[model samples]
Target: MTTPPRPWPGLFISFEGIDGSGKSTQARQLYESLRSGGHDPLLTREPGGSPGAEEIRALVLQGDPDRWSAETELLLFTAARRDHMERAILPALQAGRTVICDRFADSTRMYQGRGGLRDKVDALHDLMIGIDPDLTLLIDMPAEAGLARAKSRATDEERFEDFGLDLQQRMRDGFLALAAAAPARFRVIDGNRDMDSVARDVHATVLRELAPSS
Candidate 1:
């Protein structure tokens, strides 16, 4: 059992995109930039932020595609998120620190919900993890290009990427649709350019979002 988190006065920023979309890179850059500019920012990732959640991340990420059923994976992801919220995210946010997460519930919604379990995913999130990011930065690009970048990566966490180009394309489309539905909280950035340009757009967008609170 864990102690409940206090209300977060700070901002909660999440980055979402398909594999190889460069969200991770942009997220890190934002964290570093904020830190250098004298801001209190906490950088974290989904499925693996807190200690317990990190352990679960290995289980879900490094296994065969069919190792866990969609339902089971949903449960596992929710549990990990619950733990991460309790241990890592809420604490920093309570301290008025910006929490920049690499991924969040949106990822779960898109990845696990790609199948027929979208309703279940939302229900579980509402029940077990009832919070959403204040802002979500979506790195958008062509599916084939993103898939190629993802395939070039030499990591064991290729379970999702192994699903092939069709799934990647679908995921990209789903992400775009999600952004469209929530224009206020979602900022879509073109990711086909050089890393520096993408990072610049991400930084400027985040600055604009944070201006009100800053």
Candidate 2:
């Protein structure tokens, strides 16, 4: 299960899902919604939030899928996250700014915590970067539909997506399991519907989280 974030005044929100689950779009939508509501929210993404992290992003995301071993990839990702937290996320939260991140440690838990490396992943996370978003919105949809959507406009970062449908299915199941384990921290949103409908749910869920004192 995920733990609460450090006691910061800012609300930390993260969007999670399998590739092409529309999580990135929803994250952006929520950021826009918060801005429109007169809240100062910082929009960011994992594996590349700070300049140092962005450098590692290309190294892991591009090139052949077999370019780096899963263990190496894990270290690279964790390093990027550490830099991102130090340079961007932590400071924003410290300033009492809502940090809206497209992805976070959960992505590492999914993407790299495979092939029996979950224990290592968790251990490293606890040792190096020990924080999770207060709330994570998981955009859920069928794996087939999501893979199809992901491949439509695939780019060089397509290394992960290129794993094809089987991996996508496993990732979807893994994500759902993660959500089930941490119900209080996760809001599972259906992403198979139209974009507007999905955005409405995302917006409403976030509003409830912010209602306590925003």
Candidate 3:
């Protein structure tokens, strides 16, 4: 008798942070650790995965400073995400590769929703109705600290990152709110801690999630 085809098994995890939170660093650390531990992992980022998404990312990030609006930015991000999911993320997962995304839908909800366009948050939600991360890590940090760190590293700030302090603060609050609403899926990490400590906690969190329930 012929045997049935084997199915690919995978997991999806996303990292989120306002700025200077070191989420991208930690996400890379986790991705390395997963691979070192013998897991098939795919490390990718939003707004720039597939070719289509890359084009959108260029427009979103490198646009004229005064040429963009909040709603336009949000729509661009969501469009990139939709293309990324269908072309990169979903395919990798189905092929049995654990997918790690640096930023995802939550970033839009936090940045656009709480930053200034609170009215557009629901519309953004509608854009990401079916996409959900199996795990989301929120690297929480103060707005001032994050801004400082972000500025230190970036030679020229992107439009969103260049927003006012109040906007960044509200974005941080948005992340916290989402974490509170979904304790099981969202892990809030204090970004003020040492890098080693943050990485250690991320490792522990991933292991715990991979472990079988009691």
Candidate 4:
């Protein structure tokens, strides 16, 4: 079991899914919706939210897909995440601002675990970054659909997306398993729908979390 972080006054939400599941789009939409509704929300992304982390992002996302061994990549990601937490996430939460992150440790668990480093990834996360999001929205979809979508984007950040369809299917399954393991914090949303429909579900989920408990 993963240890939770100390209690925080602000809300922290994260999005997780296979590459190209439209999780990023939904996260941005939620941020926009929150701002329009007069809420102060900080939108950020993993491995690159803070200045130092962004540098690490290029190192991880660029280069040959096999540039780093699984263990080495995990270390780099952990270092980046630590910097992100210290510089960006922690401070925002301390100020009582909602932080919507595009991806978090779950991505590491899924991606690295695929390379037979599941135990190492979990241990590193528990030791260095025990913080879990208040809510994680998993955008569920078929791997093929997601891969098609991701390939169309054609960004230089193709290291992960280029892993092919088989890996993506495994990742999709891995994310669902993680959600099943932690049902309370994970909301599995159907990502096969239209953008507006998916955004509606994401928006509703965040609103419920933000609502005052009666």
Candidate 3: residue 125 Cα off by (Å)? 4.3
lDDT of 3 at 150: 79
Report the number of clashing residue pairs per model.
0, 0, 0, 0
The local lDDT score (0 to 100) that residue 186 gets in candidate 1 is 96
Cα lDDT tens digits, model 3, 52-154, are 9988887877646556777877788878888898899999979877888998888877765644675576666565646678889899989898878876785
TM-score-better candidate, 1 vs 4: 4
- Candidate 2 per-residue C-alpha lDDT over 1-214 given as tens digits, one digit per residue, 9 for 90 to 100: 3344458988899999999999999999988999999999999998799999999999998988899999999999999999999999989999999999998999889989988999999999999999889999999999999989889974878898889998999889999999999998999999999999999999999888776542
Candidate 3 residue spans exceeding 4 A from truth: 1-8, 115-129, 155-157
Query: Which candidate ranks first by lDDT, i.e. highest?
Result: 4
Per-residue alpha-carbon lDDT of candidate 1 for residues 2-109, written as tens digits (9 for 90 to 100): 333435678899999999998899899999999998998999999899999999999999878899999989999999999999999988888899999999999999
- Arranged by lDDT with the best first, the candidates are 4, 2, 1, 3
Better of 2 and 4 by lDDT: 4
Instruction: Name the runs in model 4 displaced over 4 angstroms.
Output: 1-6
lDDT at 27, model 3? 90
* The 10-residue segment with the lowest total lDDT in model 4: 1-10
lDDT of 4 by residue, 1-110 (tens): 44445378789999999888999999999999999999999999998999999999999998788999888999999999999999999999889899999999999999
TM-score of decoy 1 = 0.94
lDDT of 3 at 99: 88
Better of 1 and 3 by TM-score: 1
